[model samples]
Target: MELPVVKYNRSHYIETDTGNKVSRKSVIYGSQNITLSGKTIIQAGCVIRGDLRRAGGGQTLVIAIGRYCLLGENSVIRPPHKTYKGVFSYYPMKIGDYVAIGENSIVEAANIGNHVQIGKNCIIGRFAIIKDGCRIEDHTVIAPNTVIPSFSVYSGSPGRLVGELPECAPEMYEARSKEFYSKFMAT
Candidate 1:
């Protein structure tokens, strides 16, 4: 079935803080159910949907993107809880502050800590825990139900823990976030 079209009533185009523009043709549903806060960027051709089972369910899909998050073009983010038993449920995608994700990536995990970078075309498995100060390189496939501890970099098919990130310091993390906000966001 073809997806429904949504018109952006406020603006002609959806321009994110990271200088990413979600084309007007893109579909954004569950506006009443989905809440977007802080400075975040979501690119073009992306789909943001809420609960599918319950059309009138009062529960809204919570995708909390902390300050300075860059969701690349054509990315998809859904709530944590999966629908089973022929029923729709609500789950929260809790994202901490200062996270950057590359293009065409799929994130359905839980709690990506502060200052984490997930590369392009990557798939973050369910229940995979990515702690703070972690960097996932491009094209890395994070296996399902894997856990990555804090301050580490994992790059592989199953996402092995390589080591601590180069800039584990909180100061460096802040700096990088600022750079992303300025370099990519300000455009």
Candidate 2:
């Protein structure tokens, strides 16, 4: 099914040369450390924390989001942190193409693969690795250090493998995300 045209106020967003639409109402820290690929949409009230890194001052990539991705309203995207040798360090979050995260989600994953769809009010725990073609249902809480395999549907509070997706899931997800981006427009 195709998505309906979603319109946003022209004055509320900043459209990039690469076709990314970022909301002015959203708070994105350390913008230089964050990379948003083309055609990505970051909705209002979202918070992307790129400033939460190690003390070393060289430019470390905190978050790298791929093409045709959407981060919904009030969502939080932060890099995962780990304490090693009595020092805390934040690792980069890498999100692949055609990913869509629903409203009110907080994702601190180490990596999210292509065609992944995460639902509303979800909490993807720190250092979790979600593989390609995965669907995480609404209000789900994936545990830390969890590794979600490809082509699976996970749900519930401590998200478990509830079901398996068909082999055609990748193609379907790609089409769906692309269509959503196409219909998302400025009013």
Point out where model 1 deviates above 4 Å.
Answer: 1-12, 15-26, 52-56, 83-90, 166-169, 185-187
How well is each residue in 98-130 modelled by candidate 1, as lDDT tens digits? 787888888877678888888988888765678
TM-score of 2: 0.98
Q: Pick the candidate with the highest lDDT.
A: 2
Model 1 lDDT, residue 34, Cα: 55
Error of 2 at 55 (Å): 1.4
- Local error of candidate 2 at residue 11 (angstroms): 0.9
lDDT of 2 by residue, 1-187 (tens): 6689998899999999999999999999999999998999999999999998878868988899999999999999999999999988899999999999999999999999999999999999999999999999999999999999999999999899999999999999999988998888888
Total clashing residue pairs per candidate?
Answer: 1, 0
Instruction: Please give each candidate's TM-score.
Output: 0.75, 0.98
